[model samples]
Target: MTHPFDLSVVDRWSDERTFDVTPDAVHAYADAVGGPSPVFAVVPAMDLVFAVAETAAPADLRTRVVHGQQDLVLHKPLPVGEKVTVRAAVVGLHGKRSGTTATILVRTRDAVGDPLNEQYVTEFYRGVPTDLSVGVAAPRLPSEPPAGPPSAEAAHHLQHDLPSRYADASGDHNPIHLDDEVARAAGLPGVIVHGLASLAIAARTVLAAAGAEEARLARLSCRFTRPIAPGDTLTTRVWADGAGYRFDGLDGSGATVLGAGVAELRA
Candidate 1:
């Protein structure tokens, strides 16, 4: 079947923008995600990685797509109160039985044109069919969990206002995260926490557990397994794996929220 939208834009969809790493932006992210230290002191990873949202994309498709996965490789911590260039392009479009997934490659560079990080954001358009599989897929996480007990474990409470707070800080004002009605209309239970917000929280906990500084984070990746609503308690478990770590997060109901998580620290 022919795809409803143009598939020719696969490798051609590119966007670029400048992002300011303001002190306020950094602080706000820290407040929302529960950290002004470790993984959040220099800059919340999500604030820099999710800068792809500032890039242009098809407006119509935005409403239909849901964040599927994220893979971020950090070169260095972004400097606060400075500007960085963010460039993005649609690198892959693959069709599954239920939908099509678009893989976007986002690159962040310092003001001097030095590389800072590269992130792959995958969006799944449910019920949208496209048979074409083009370009490169995002990096995959480890298939199996490490055996035995977790090396570190921590839990965080998702405050009722966390969604709004994160929205204000991250510039992601999607109603599904702040409006219960809108979320229900979109087929969600109610107002849910932003996936990146939850991911950021998990990263902070993992880093603190490892006793590593924020700047040491070299790569982070995870698959969003389920929606995490405000007021939910998130428990993250991490296992040491050589130079990196593998982790998983569960919500209050013991349902997995993030799976196949990978976080690596630079030696």
Candidate 2:
């Protein structure tokens, strides 16, 4: 049977969106992600990435799509109250028996056209099969955890209402992350946390440990390995990997929630 999606329509196709990074927007993100630094200092890494919309896809696949991975490269830290424009293009797509994964390249620029961040966002369409698999995947990171004791560790307690708070802050009102019944219908046990929200929390923990809290973020990437539910405490572990750092998150039962995490900071 042929797949319903054309797949090539979005390939290399691009779109642009413009928005201002107001104080309220920044503060809401920081509060939701549990960032330690002042909310006004620097916008959260994931915030800059998510501010840009993903490249459009078939409407049939939209509801079944979920964030599969995120690879972010920050050229400059966006300050509060900056007007920025984000351009998103579907760079690649891979199909499998399970579903199709579309790799989107998102670029954000300040009002003066200064580069702020570049992100490779992967969206996975569950149970949507396709015979064609083309285009480049996101840049590779270490799949296995570092073989040594973690240099630093931080525990983040996710509140039961975290999903609601994060949904409000990130403008991602997916029912799977809000309504339990909807999540169950989607084959999830209950309302699961947004992948990006968990990623933002883990990124801040890694940054603080590297003592690059105030430094410009060079890169951050992670794959969503497992679902994280609300009211679960996550422990993020970071290891010094040469010049950059390797990290991952584990849930209460010690299952890897986020894997292949990599982060680097500019001097």
Candidate 3:
């Protein structure tokens, strides 16, 4: 029997999607991720990634997919009210021990073709088997905290209602995030927060610590080390690393939940 996910879709670019960035949308995204500074005139960077992925996902494998990982590189801050074009393509596909992984590349450019940002998103489909041979690589991180004391640290209390609010704002109504029964069926303790939501909070902390304009963020990358339950307190610690920073996020129990985090700020 053929797999539900069509692995043959790999390496094909989807049709281009045009988006008009609006102030209201930006504000709503900021509110969903806990507010960012008013100085940011662009939409939250991750919003673009999600928007493109919405159009890029394969129709055949929509329901049982989960976001596995993400890496974002921003060329510049996307200005509100500007028209941008997004294109997505499948860049990599691998068969892992647990499931199949599909890596999608989304690139956004200005109306005039100036590059704005690029994102690589990995999605996992549980129980879907693939014959495609590919290797799995683990994310690299420092075994211990950097030599010096952390440059910055902040604690964020993830409210119980955050998942619902994020789901509404992000258009990701995955039952695993909203329905307790659905989560338990999937072997989770209960409704867990979205990994992107946690990344947003971590990004906010990095932006604040660098004291650089939010628009100047050039790159953000992290590995989701653990699932975050609603109402958990997240503590982010950052250390200076050249023109950027290396960071890690810990849950209330001091377990590192987001690791191998790196953020680059434009000079």
Candidate 4:
């Protein structure tokens, strides 16, 4: 189905965010995943969400928005201390009949101005079938919750140089990590790290920690509950249950920053 949309006729969210990446932040996240690190690409993968959210017009655009699907291909592992600036622009748009669904194309970049990733997201806007905005029929929350026992989960950490490389790779150039001056300018104790970067580290945690190869992942989803700064220790713990795994992101102090992480594996 085809719908209607215009960039010049919608809202812009380009200069709306700031961040910091600190030395302490590096240690925290790197320690969580593992001392060294393994390359788990997430640049364009998670960045697509940011790009779509920034470029899309929810108020003016049609409703019935449901996250249809997402995909990401990592070029290489991002190093810590790298600068990343995230900017998203709508590259393409197509519609489903009766406004039943629409696909959006977004591209993200890093601070040094490199193509970090591309995201194509689809939402079912317009033509309301029914008002079931709750329960299994409703959308799920974006934030994850604390994990209970260890059944099935993914665990990982970030390296000291990872933030800098990721910032450049993801186009989420928040100063918290790249610019110390910017970090001081912000009210944070220091530069705050990109939540997606942490999320990426968490995404790999499930695989590396569980000793499962990448091919084991069938489906994965999680919520960004808190912001993480560079140099901080981030530990992702995972557990297995039923046909999938439950996971969570933790701070150096063992605080649950991200929760309700789930991953379905293929047999």
Q: Each model's TM-score, in the order given?
A: 0.90, 0.89, 0.83, 0.50
Worst 10 residues of 4 by lDDT: 130-139
lDDT by candidate, in order shown: 0.78, 0.76, 0.72, 0.49
- In candidate 2, stretches whose alpha carbon ends up further than 4 angstroms from where it belongs are 36-57
Give the residue spans of candidate 4 off by over 4 A.
Answer: 1-42, 45-53, 56-148, 151-160, 180-187
On TM-score, the stronger of 1 and 2 is: 1
After superposition, which runs of candidate 3 have C-alpha atoms over 4 Å from their true positions?
A: 1-5, 37-64, 126-131, 134-149
Cα distance off (Å), candidate 4, residue 61: 18
**Error in Å for residue 86 of model 3:** 1.4
Per-residue alpha-carbon lDDT of candidate 2 for residues 25-66, written as tens digits (9 for 90 to 100): 877877888863321222333343333323345564566877
Per-residue lDDT value at 261 in model 2: 91
**Separate clash counts for every candidate:** 0, 0, 0, 77
| Residue range 150-202, candidate 1, lDDT tens digits | 98999999999999998888777788898999888778899999888888999
Ranking by lDDT: 1, 2, 3, 4
Per residue, candidate 3 scores C-alpha lDDT tens digits across 144-249 of: 6556888999999999988998887666677889999988877678998887788888888888898877778887877777778999999999989988898888
Off by over 4 Å in 1: 13-15, 37-61
Higher-TM-score candidate of 2 and 4: 2
Better of 1 and 4 by lDDT: 1
RMSD of each: 3.0, 3.2, 4.0, 11.1
